[model samples]
Target: MEPHTGEICAHSMFESEEEELAGQAQAWKYTFAFVESLAVKSVVLLGIPDIIARHGPKATLSLSQIAAELPSEKPDVNCLFRILRFLVAKNFFRAETSGGANEVRYGLTPASKWFVKGGAAAPSVSMIAMLLMQNDVTMMAPWHHFNECVLDGGVAFEKAHGLHLWDYAAAHPDQNCLFNQAMACNANIVMKAILSKYEGFQGLNSLVDVGGGIGATLAEIVKAHPSINGISYDLPHVVAMAPHYPGVKHIGGDMFREVPSADAVFMKWIMHDWEDEDCVKILKQCRKAIPETGKVIIVDTVLNPREKTALDPSMGLVFDLAMIAHTVGGKERSEEEWKNLLKEAGFPRFNIIAIPALQSVIEAFPY
Candidate 1:
């Protein structure tokens, strides 16, 4: 082989014009990925989905028709069209072109229907999640410190806000309320998926939702399983805000110290917020709360680490980075990592049940 020069190597890397274009497109896609999130946020805030829903379920509206309903006295049709056009490409809305002038009409896709609050279809769970997550002022600030966090080994949120996430929430009531609402929305979606397929709660006499905020999740569980006495456990401040729910009791305490005693202990989206040591401590507390026959039921993501396989785990992987950005020592763990945590926490045997949702149902038995 002939000796290779830098110019020759660089030319060989591209090989073809198509490969060069593909590489450039992929790079640009990653660079502009946040645009999609901002676009979705814009539509949600503008009540675009709700506006279209008012027309009718199967109704399609022209750009001018939709723009007419905007709150602004004079809404810019071109700007609105640009936003809708991008969303159309992403499949949030379906676009139809008609007439010689190529007039584009937009209709709600199944995905967009969820965002239509108070419409025929259910209100969006992600709408709440997105508001909290995509808030440029607070949530996005943490990402600015991502580099600092990587170098200094500290939470980006704390670095950005000068306080831990919990402390920050406590200090800011509105943000805290939004966060709780987001959690409840997420729990509602997950519980719906879980209750439909899983029967573990069928025979239980009682269940405790550790870290349950406002008792919303526990309330649903109690409603579903009338036989199971439900206890919602969380910090004093959080439980203080919870409303009265029939067949459900709200209790305040630290999970590291104690959890409410019950036939089974339940935690959703809690473990991923803490380090392994903290998780083990919480798990040990959970172990003590349950009886010999009792089990700890965990509703959280079981990460699949394989790259670009059949089942897409992009969300779980992104959540892992989110954990890094938001918490000191939190992450979405693989199945093997979960096993190690369980074993360390004194739960010798556990079964992971795949749910219809992004999170899996883990039953960790003390026996």
Candidate 2:
């Protein structure tokens, strides 16, 4: 082998044109990844999905037709066309242009169908609110301090906003409402999946959903299982906003102090926001709330570290990093970590059930 005379740069490392192009493709794909998210947000903001849906079943509307449906007095057709084209490539919408048609037409895909407002496919948490919150300036600003947060052991959200997330939201009611709406929408999807498959509530007379924000999730459950009653328990302020649903009652209190006694305690997406010690405390409180025969139902991501070949866990890692960046000491956990937490919290054993959703269900028994 001959020694290299010059420094090996990124371009020099690629042996062939094919390799260089491949590297460039991967690099540019990542660089432009956020564009897809922003595109989704834009589509929601413009109410394109709803507009297209109004055109009737399997409707295909031309660019001019879509523009006519918009609220703007003078809609920018050219820019809107550009955005529609991008979304079309991402499969959020389908594009069709005829030989005689001067402009391209678009139609909704299955994914985009969920964004149609007042459509049966849409959830309580509007798609517009959810998209805006996910890509919000306040939330995304934390990523700028990603490295600083690790080195300084500082809360990234606090560093970005000069206050904790909850405090910031409390001060900004609009943002808080947006966050809650997104959560409620997400819970609606998850709750349907839970009822369809899981038997966690079987034969149980009562279930208390801890940190149940608006009672929408449990309200559906109480209606589904008329023999059982449900309670949505959260902080006083959050519980105040819950709508009155028959068979499902709302209670205001602190989970750390006490959770309303029930045959089963259900908590979803709550533990990942707290550290290990805090989780133990919360689970212990849940243990006290349920009887010996009853169990605690937890719906959260269960990190499958050992599943190296089964499925892509990129979504799981995204949430895990989010916990790190957003919380004081929160993180996703492996199965071993979950077991240890359960044992420490006075639960002798537990069973984890897989669901088609983003989170798993863990049924842990009382001591």
Backbone atom clashes (below 3 Å) for every candidate: 0, 0
Cα lDDT tens digits for candidate 2, 261-359: 999999988899889999998998998898888999998888874324234566778888888656767788778989999999999889888776767
Q: Model 1 misses residue 18 by how many Å?
A: 3.1
Worst 10 residues of 2 by lDDT: 305-314
Q: Once superposed on the true structure, which residue ranges of model 2 sit more than 4 Å away at CA?
A: 1-8, 124-128, 305-312
The candidate that achieves the highest lDDT relative to the unseen native structure = 1
Off by over 4 Å in 1: 1-15, 98-102, 124-126, 305-311
CA RMSD of all predictions = 3.0, 3.0
TM-score of each: 0.92, 0.91
lDDT of 1 by residue, 230-335 (tens): 9999988788889999999999989989988899999999999999999999999999999999999999888873323334677898878878777879999998
> How many backbone overlaps does candidate 2 show?
0
